[model samples]
Target: MSLPELLLAGFLLLSVLGALLLSLPIAAEQPLNWHQALFTATSAVTVTGLGVVDTSSLSLFGQLVVLGLIQVGGLGFMTCAAMMMVLLGMRLPLYQKRLISESLEHTSFAELAQMVRLVVGFALATELAGTLLLSLVWMPEHGVAAGLWISAFHAISAFNNAGFSLWPDSLAREVADPLVNGVISLLFIVGGLGFVVIAELANWRPGRGLSLHARITLHASGGLILAAMACVLLFEWDNPATLGGLEGLGAKLQAAWFQAVTPRTAGFNTLDIGAMTTPSALLTMLWMFIGAGSGSTASGIKVTTFMVLLLVARAFLKGQARPVAFGRSLSARTVMEAVAVALAGMLLVFGCLLALTITEPGQDFLGLAFESVSAFATVGLSRGVTAELSASGQLVLIATMLLGRVGPISLGYLLATRKTESLRFAEGRVHVG
Candidate 1:
């Protein structure tokens, strides 16, 4: 098979294995049926937290299996496989290197080994630190054993931008807790800022500057978080089911900030997502669609794509020849790729929504749209519509999650594949409004 086909097949094989394991009697209090097992496995493999059953319904072994799947999924299994090869001191063949580079959205084959080491090492170290810090908060309430397990689970989940939580309400009880709010949000934020940016930050020194890509990622992430936070605060401030119920400025701000951060495809929620006003819900969907950095655990068209769209529009309005940032001009190809990603993402979400309407005609349109975007972006935040959907509707989401996770990368591969053209076509013009 070609590299892209191989790459996609690997994920599928792993998801199937996960499904088989999850279906075993040991995996759940009551063994899940094949479809349920497959759906859960796919969601876990995609690092999208949407689930048909409560996580707590799973036995200890089952939860661990899910956690393993999350780690493998969050850091692509190819990276894990390559990391194993590195540990064994085996040379990466050209094909293996190509697969590793493709998985990470990286361009350098020579750096694959080093990048793999860094990615795995950083991920484990960061997750360990998160576990320790979170333990301090939960240990006093729940005993050491339970507290530690919870901490470990959430730390891994947050850092992976996989919003799976043991609690049904998903950190709502800690909405006002400063420690919980701070740690979880920080984990996802750092995780969502793809490893490329992380590696740059790690090696950064005085007198050396970040690349244009890193700069735009950092600036756009911060800008989006702040903008979303402000908008959530404004739109939900008077809604008693959301921000208005909070006691003080600190609590409200914490929840608002978290709500803003989660929509960048993290999927954790401090407030009642289904209870938020229509405006806040719409805003959240927009951010969910934009998502975080490229090659990050989170999925969507990615923050850079959204920023490029904005830059392109600004240039058009100003009558500039090209979109430029940080004194560097974006090539036409780059701009066209950005537009393509955005349009494709929109169509993906639209297609899912259309499918849901057919399978679930009685459901609210807005809720269905929110669920469709959530699934396609792999954001996992639903408007409480997930459980209500019929099996067919859920199947539509299962496909969406799988496709959403791999679609962009696969699309990139197809576009980048060289195709010989024997002749040049004549220029054609079309009029637009």
Candidate 2:
């Protein structure tokens, strides 16, 4: 099978396996029907945190299963499979190399296995740090055992960008708590930077700088995060239901910061997302659609894609021959691939929204659009429409989640296609609007 097909099949199989396990009576505190199990499993496998059922209601075993699913999902099944292969002293085939190359957004596979090893170790170390830091806050409040569990779970979820919270309101109690807010926002930020960028940055010296791709990803991601934060703070500065509900400037700013970054595909909400102002919600939708870096746990068109489009637009205005960034000219193929990825993402969200319009005619366009973008981006930040949706709507989201996880990779494959020319064709010109 092609890379796209393989990815689709593998993710589907994992989702089904997860669903079957979650459906077991031992998995949940209450009986879990097939639909609920399937939806939860799909969400977990996709690393999208949208949940129809509250995660706190699940038994320990079920939560563990979800955590395991998030780890594998965040790391990509093919990466895990490659790790096992490396452990067994097996060499990767051409196909495996290609998959890893594309999935990790690496230009080549010279150090592929080494990079994968670093990825695993980095994830383990980061999650451990987050767990310990979070334990400091929750252990005092929830008691040692429960606090430890919550810390570990949140660390994993936050690092994976899974956004699954055992608490019903999702860290709402800790909006003003600096420890919880800081650690989580940082975790997701690193998680969403893409493993390749992390690995490269880890080995860097101050004067040595970094590669073009790494630089672009970092600069663009940082800019977007700051921009999103500013927008949210401005739009929600006086919304009584959101930022305004807090006590003081310190708490409000902290809440604003957390809420701002969450929509960068983190999904955890410090504020009541449903009660957010229309402008704030719309700004969040835009940030969620922009999403995190490629090969990261968080998903959307990706930071690189967003940057490429901006560069392309700038080049167009300047009448340049090609899109250039960081003093390097990007090939036409790369720009086209970026365009395809963004276009595919938009189409997927729009198609899901259209279907949802039929399945849920009661909700307004903004709510459904937010939900659709959230699902399609795998951001998992919903606006209270998820729980109220019908079974059909849930299925629509399931498909959308799968598409979110698989769609960009598939589009990547599509963009890689090279059509050989047997003869030259006449030049055709079209009018611009």
Candidate 3:
């Protein structure tokens, strides 16, 4: 099988295995039906976080099972396999190297071993640090044992950008708490930045600067985060259900910042997302669709793709031959790939929305649209529509999550498999306004 096909199969197998495990009576307080089990399992394996069941209600073993799925899904099955090989001191074969390189989008095949180490090592170290810091905040409240467990679960979820919270209200209780907000936000932000960027930053020196991809990821991410923050503050400041009820500007800003960045495919929100104004909700959906960097835990069309599209527009308006960024000209192939990814993502989201409309006729269009984007992007933010959806509606989301997880990788496969024209064809042209 092809690499993308293998990846899809691997992920599906993991999801199925997870579902089977979760279906066991010991996994939950009450036995979950097949659909509920599959949905939760698929959500975990895809790192999408949309749920038909409350995770907090799950037994300790079930939560651990979900965490295991989250870790594997976020790093990917191939990554986990590679980590094992590295640990065993096995020399990675050429085909294995190709798979890892393509999967991670790592450029240097020669240094693939080191890259795998960095990926696994950095993830473990960061999760550990986050857990310890979060323990300080939760231990005072939930006490020693439960607090540590909560801290550990959230640390893994946050660093994986899975957005799974044991609490029914998520982190809303700590909306004004700096330590909770800071550690959680920081973990996801760094995680969503992608492993390549992380590896580069770790080895970066003053004389040797960052790569273009790193630069673009950092700049676009920072700009988007700030822009979303401003938009949230502007649109929701006066809304009673969201930021408006906050006592002061400081707390409001903190909430705005958290809400703003969460939509960059992190999915943890402090505010009542369903209660936000239409504009704020729309903005949130847009960011969820944009997502974070490629090769990251979060998924969407990706920030890099979004920026490349912007560059394409700028080049067209400036009458330039090619899109340029950071003192480099993007290849025509890159532009086409970006267009393909964006178009495919839009089509998937639209199809999911259309399907949901048919499956959930009583639902509002806006809420359905939000759910569609959230599911496809794996952002997991809901406008209180998830649990209320019918079985068919939930099934539509389950399919969306699965396809959304593999769509980009499959697109990459299609793009990579393209063949150049063997013979030149006659020039064909069409007119447009």
| RMSD list, candidates in order | 1.1, 1.3, 1.1
Residue 13 in model 1: lDDT: 86
Q: What does candidate 3's lDDT look like per residue over 62-119, in tens digits?
A: 9999999999999878877887988998888887787788767644788888888888
User: Which ranges of candidate 2 are over 4 A from the true structure?
Assistant: none
Tens digit of per-residue lDDT, candidate 1, span 329-401 = 9998789779888999999999999999999999999999999999989888988999787889989998899
TM-score of 1: 0.98
Count of residue pairs whose backbone atoms collide, per candidate: 0, 0, 0
lDDT, each prediction: 0.91, 0.90, 0.91
Q: Which residue pairs clash in candidate 2?
A: none
Alpha carbon lDDT of residue 241, candidate 2?
Answer: 88
| TM-score of each candidate structure, all chains considered together | 0.98, 0.97, 0.98
lDDT of 3 at 21: 97
**Residue lDDT tens for model 2, 127-171:** 999999999998998999999999999999999998999988998
lDDT of 3: 0.91
